[model samples]
Target: MAVAAIAGGTFAFKALDKSVKLVVDGKTQSVSTYASNVEGVLKDANVKVVKRDDLTPKLTAAVADGGTIVLNRARPLAIDIDGVHSKKWVTAYTVEEALSQLGIDGGADVSASRSQRLPLKGASLEVTTPKTVAINVDGQAISVVSTGATVKDVLDAQSISLVEGDFTTPAVDTPVTSGMQVDVTRVRTTTTQEAQPVPYSTSEQPDGTMNKGDKKVVTKGVAGEQVVTYTVTTTNGVVSAKTQVSAQVTVAPVNEVVNVGTKEAPVAAAPAPSGSGAGSSGGGSNAGAIPSSGGLNWPALAQCESSGNPKAVSPAGYMGLYQFDQRTWNANGGSGSPLDASAAQQTAIAQNLYNARGISPWPSCGPKLLS
Candidate 1:
């Protein structure tokens, strides 16, 4: 009976004394206690356990031999939700648990990953709740719930496609905000013709046959008309880009060709006497050079008519420097063809004809000899 009492007393003393380890947040401490329960042990260590704090072994449970009691103090975790600053007191182990404990669900996007454990001192996490946004495509508006960060992401999320000549308002690279208005414009191009004036070109050539210092227009230039086809792109009733596709000339341009004379001027002859008379039958062929008669200049008129060549002929079978036909030469007291007569004889006959006819013949080229 004495040995049994001693054994029971030893067992009772061993039960009263327990070895336990306490871990608060990340810190650890050892405590040798005679407390019988977790509450008693917490009382001995001067640790007050609250309902919000986490405990590995519950405070109401009996203390175990060499067992651990982990106390994670509840802390308020800051949350940024839709630009609203909020906080939730939690005792969860990781980011996912914390959100779940706070009644946050519905596949919410957390700035921090779910696997990331809570630190000793809690950190912040951003919760972005997806919202519906309206997108305008080709003047049609459509609404969709999206968690996209940019306009392009939202369009791709909805399986919207974009091709060449397609554009969007607020730009496709811009970040999407809640209730943001997105406009998409479709561009179409067409080939069109526009009439345009084509300028004419000028060309010059040297002409040795024309009189020296003389200018002539070989061909007159005219400005032509042409139609140019352009590839024009229009976006929602607005012009975007234009480029020439093809060109056609309806009226071809005429180039101006001008003749530039390079010929040498003829040398002026000695002035004949103003009173010099034509040869009479009495004086023979040694007649003085006649300059003018009856208010008519003979020498200059003969020069203009036939370039002062006494043996010159006309296309109408006219003869002599005075351009007379055979019948006219005989009527003017000329015996044979005017080509057979000497310059003095031809001049005498021309003077007689001029005196009688009063300079009515040779009107076209004769007026230029007045000066």
Candidate 2:
């Protein structure tokens, strides 16, 4: 009876024993455990399971004979996709397996080889996917299928260089995306100088030495010269904008000086001979002596009215250096069209008209007579 009890105990022990195949992180090994559940079997084999680890069977499940158990140890991994960085817990042993489990396919560019082993502690990986983008530059449309990480990478691959004033629509540092359009605008800037005329100002001073209606020029006016600098921008070989950046006066204007008469006449010089004098109706007034110097600026008025051309004729039937109409010319002792007379003759008539009108005839050009 004692021998039979020992045999029965041995049978019970054999019945409880289980033969299981244990795979830890892709390494296979056979384990023999007398424990009843999966947890007990793993404990007997000295295999640890963490929350982040992948376990094929539940810990509380009953252990079966000749069963397979898979336990993939989770590892820390740093991943960068198109410049965006992230950390992931992956249960794969190799880079290829990790990518597959992360839903990454073969068309992506990776920093490490697909078959490289993923270390248990940690490993870093950079990924770039193929994208379709249109590049418009230099008046041409270029289509690209690239695996670059950013817009700058794409441009560099195409041998495109950016100058100081050059720019892109989507900045060069921007991440690349599918179906994104990139426009490169070629800019060229230049500074140009141009000469500009500055109108001269007039100033007047009273002089008591001259007669009431007499005037004398003391200084001649000169227009000033200025150099204007412009910032000209050209885009794609076309002028886009021209902005005035600076202006410098190279030559200053010399103001004109004139003396006006403020003295009273000496009793009209005892009413001298009135024969063929100024303002006379004689047909020979062209040879008559008329005072050239006057209260107004006659030369300036002629320059403003007819550009100093004595024979100048206006479309309004006005003629001569003073732009006189026919009726006014006849009233001012002018014969026929003022253009038919000599410059001296025209001047005499103009002086006679000025003595009568007091600079009211040339309304537009009268202001130019100021000192």
Candidate 3:
């Protein structure tokens, strides 16, 4: 009986000597034969301790018989929050859980989408707050700004100014967020003047004739003038520039008149016959005394043709009291220059008629015998 009791005791002692296997970061470790939980295994392995250490199955959970223990070492990481960098140690199993433990909420005003995965161990994290702001000037839309600060801070960064008449949607002191919009506008005006050239009237005298330096009222041209109205533009009560919009002529101009004349006189006749017979006494025999028989009345015709003036000329180059052309005078029985008559003009006319027609009658007593 004593021998049987010793064998049973030996079997029980062997079962109690069985040790637990601990696995940490893929590494295997054998714990004390007395280890029966995760805390005992970690204590036996002498693993580093930290504020947010991670353990599989939990620290307070009972250890499985012949099962393994897994421990994850927390790594030191740096974080940059809106340009401010800070160091932190975490081991919450995942990036999201680690951040949560560090007092960072995923639903905060500043957040990152799932696409922006958490950083690796010993990596840095960037936390940003996106802000939106709207700008307006004179009730007009100007610009929209997205930033991570107050409205004034964004405006200063963009080199924008807030004036008396200018305004912001949420007010300059309002906080900024992502997707905010802004607007700005300026009130202005302008002034200007325009000048126009006045037209003048021109007059030309008749061809080959002039007024001989005499001033006439021929279309007296008066100077013309005009005035224009314009709409000026200005900004902030200050005039910028002006332009002419409409124009009109106030008064009409007057035209003057002129007159002209030819300065040359008519040609003179040849000298009369000499002696007493030249002036008078050629009465009843006058008709018969005349030489030419062309049927033309000599005395009455000559007086009428020349208007009783010895000097006369038609525009067609006819000359003398008889108004004889050069060709006709040359064909007569007279001599010397046709235009210059010492006594030749009258004699030429008489001779020409007599030769062309024929003498009708002859006289011996009236106004006679003067060569």
lDDT of 1 by residue, 1-371 (tens): 99999999999887778788988765688888998788888888888888789887887788877978888778779997755788788887688878888877657678888988787477898876676789888667899887776789889988888888788888898867788888888888888899999999999899987543345688999999999999999987688899998889999999899886676534334232232221111112222343343345667766656656565665566666577878888987899687677666676677667655656666754664465
Ranking of all candidate structures by their lDDT, best first: 2, 1, 3
In order, what lDDT does every prediction score?
Answer: 0.73, 0.77, 0.51
What is the C-alpha lDDT profile of model 2 across 220-334, one tens digit per residue? 7899999999999999889999999998999998888877678653321111222222222222212222223445455556556665555555556566566778888889788
Q: Kindly report which residue stretches of model 1 are placed more than 4 angstroms away from their true locations once superposed.
A: 1-4, 14-34, 41-72, 75-78, 83-88, 138-141, 159-167, 170-180, 187-231, 236-371
Better of 1 and 2 by TM-score: 2
In model 2, the clashing pairs are: 203-371
Whole-structure CA lDDT of model 3: 0.51
- What global local distance difference test value does model 1 have? 0.73
Which consecutive 10 residues in model 1 have the weakest lDDT in total? 275-284
Q: Tens digit of lDDT per residue, candidate 3, span 172-279?
A: 776565666654444443344455534556564542232122223456666666666677865545566677788776654444444332322122332332212212
Best by lDDT: 2
Of the two candidates 2 and 3, the one with more favorable TM-score, higher being better, is: 2
Give me the runs in candidate 3 sitting further than 4 Å from their true place: 1-14, 17-34, 37-39, 43-47, 51-72, 107-121, 130-371
